[model samples]
Target: EDKLSQEEKQSRANHLMEVQEQISYDLNQEKIGKTFKVLIDKKEGGHFVGRTEFDSVEVDNEVLIDASKFYCRVGDFVQVKISEATEFDLYGEVV
Candidate 1:
């Protein structure tokens, strides 16, 4: 039989979390350099924030547009080219 100490258990759990996060980052990284339709749902400062058609685990992609260059309202759909991606969000440009 084998047993792990509390510290060892915590270390393994932390490592697992790191692996999960890296996997998530890698999966999201694949989305970069791609374009998708974004549905506007929020606005702040000079940016218009929105969600994409793709939704997984209740964590939808967030698209941001510069209000100075793009004009859109709530419920409007816009095409965006993915520029960056994070574990929880995405950044893009109007296309």
Candidate 2:
């Protein structure tokens, strides 16, 4: 802690955060317009919250399935065609 100035430490932290954000954005971009198998986790408002096979229940990204297009229950696995993606969430429809 004594080796670096407070400003230096803050700059390093900010840089790391920016790099993490960029990596997440790039990964999400790759999923756009792609399809993946996802497990329905729960319902949020009018959308079904789900996680793809590559996602972790606790930390990985989740996809929001438009509930109006299909009826799904929690814990059900379904294929989703990804339409949009953000750094942390994806929006899609059941395929």
Candidate 3:
């Protein structure tokens, strides 16, 4: 396979970093806008934490299920409600 040039590699890295930063910022803001299918990976005090297939656990985004109204069991593919969203994550309830 052909290797990327230094400039190209840097450019790609920068782009990825920008996307990651955007996602991170969005998650912190809890601005969920779209809906997605998510699995309940684990539970926190008031947060049902999981990751989207498009999102990486540590690098990409997370699916934040509102513990109040979102109904989901671990590994279940349920429709989630996106009340708040961020570039890297979304806060949703089960619909």
Residues 1-95, candidate 2: write the lDDT tens digits. 39999999999999998999889989998999999999999999999999999889879898998888888999999999999988889998898
TM-score of 1: 0.71
Q: Candidate 2 has which clashing residue pairs, if any? A: none
Backbone clashes per model, in order? 0, 0, 8
Worst 10 residues of 2 by lDDT: 58-67
Candidate 3 regions off by >4 Å? 1-20, 23-32
Per-residue lDDT tens digits of candidate 1, residues 1-95?
A: 55888899999999998998788788879989999899888787888988888864246556777788878888888898888888767778888
Lowest summed lDDT over 10 consecutive residues: which window, candidate 3? 26-35
Q: In lDDT terms, how accurate is model 2?
A: 0.91
Query: In order, what is each prediction's RMSD in angstroms?
Result: 3.1, 1.5, 5.6
Considering lDDT, which of the candidate structures 1 and 2 is the better prediction for this target?
Answer: 2
Better structure of 1 and 3 per TM-score: 1
lDDT tens digits by residue: candidate 3, 2-92: 6889899999999998987876785557545566777678888778888665655676567778777665677777677577765566777
Which rank order by lDDT, best down to worst? 2, 1, 3
Stretches > 4 Å off in candidate 2? none
lDDT of candidate model 3 versus the reference: 0.72
